[model samples]
Target: MSLGNTLSKYFNNRAETSEKHWDKDLQTHYYKTTKDKGLAKLEEIISGSSEYKINSVSTDHGEISFHVVKGKKAFVIGTVIMVRPYQTAIDFTVTTESALPFDFGYSSKLIKKLYERINKDLPLLDKQN
Candidate 1:
């Protein structure tokens, strides 16, 4: 990672996963599952954790929003979209709640941690870089 990218992440309180993200961990991930199945897996993973409190789930919109209330407070949104029959894409948006200006990359680390857990439940086809 370049200094610019690293510093940006540290200086920001939010991080989002996208196909063209510079950080590999922040890149969009694809799973070998249907949209509903993918969403269910994510729901299970997040809801199963004591670190998160689910705010809402919308299967129609393919999105799940939640709050991290155990440790550092943050809002998280997971988006599950099935691009093809067996190819689904999941992305995350995390915003850390802190008294300071930034969470020192906490939001990014949270996304990475969530991805790690989700990878165990769903088959990771590839990372969409």
Candidate 2:
């Protein structure tokens, strides 16, 4: 591996669990569902993923927050906000518990995977609506 890659891995392995890199590593997604339904679907998608484990959930103030553990090294904080009657916004921040200052792009990849799953699952929800 390149020097940068090796260094990233080393740092990531040593990174602190309590530190969150949200300032530079955050993703947002928009969905066409009500706030309540969007929160429910978000919970379902995260819970259904074998790679993620739900840590906590809160629904209040017109938004939902989810704390999830992704795999063994990463923690993900997801928020669902009601933007309009039929529009909702989902935001995710992923942080790695390692010594490294970087996660080798794991955070973005995790967000993408989550987005894909939610997108794919929406059709099923639509069928039931």
In model 2, which regions exceed 4 Å deviation?
1-27, 61-72, 123-129
Model 2 error, position 5 (Å): 16
lDDT, each prediction: 0.93, 0.59
By summed lDDT, the worst window of 10 consecutive residues in model 1 runs over: 120-129
TM-score of each model, paired residue for residue: 0.96, 0.66
Model 1 whole-model lDDT (C-alpha atoms):
0.93
Give the range where candidate 2 is weakest over 10 consecutive residues by summed lDDT. Answer: 13-22
Could you give candidate 2's per-residue lDDT for residues 1-129 as a string of tens digits?
A: 477644664445222111123322233556678877877888887777666677777777443333445454677666777666666766666676666676666656666666677787553222112
Give the distance in Å from residue 100's predicted Cα in candidate 2 to where it truly belongs: 1.2
Best prediction by lDDT: 1
Q: What is the C-alpha lDDT profile of model 1 across 19-96, one tens digit per residue?
A: 989999999999999999999989998889889999999999999999999989999999999998899999999999
State the displacement of the C-alpha of residue 82, model 1, in Å, after optimal TM-score superposition.
0.5
Q: Candidate 1: misplaced stretches above 4 Å?
A: 127-129
**For every candidate, C-alpha RMSD to the true structure in Å:** 1.3, 7.8
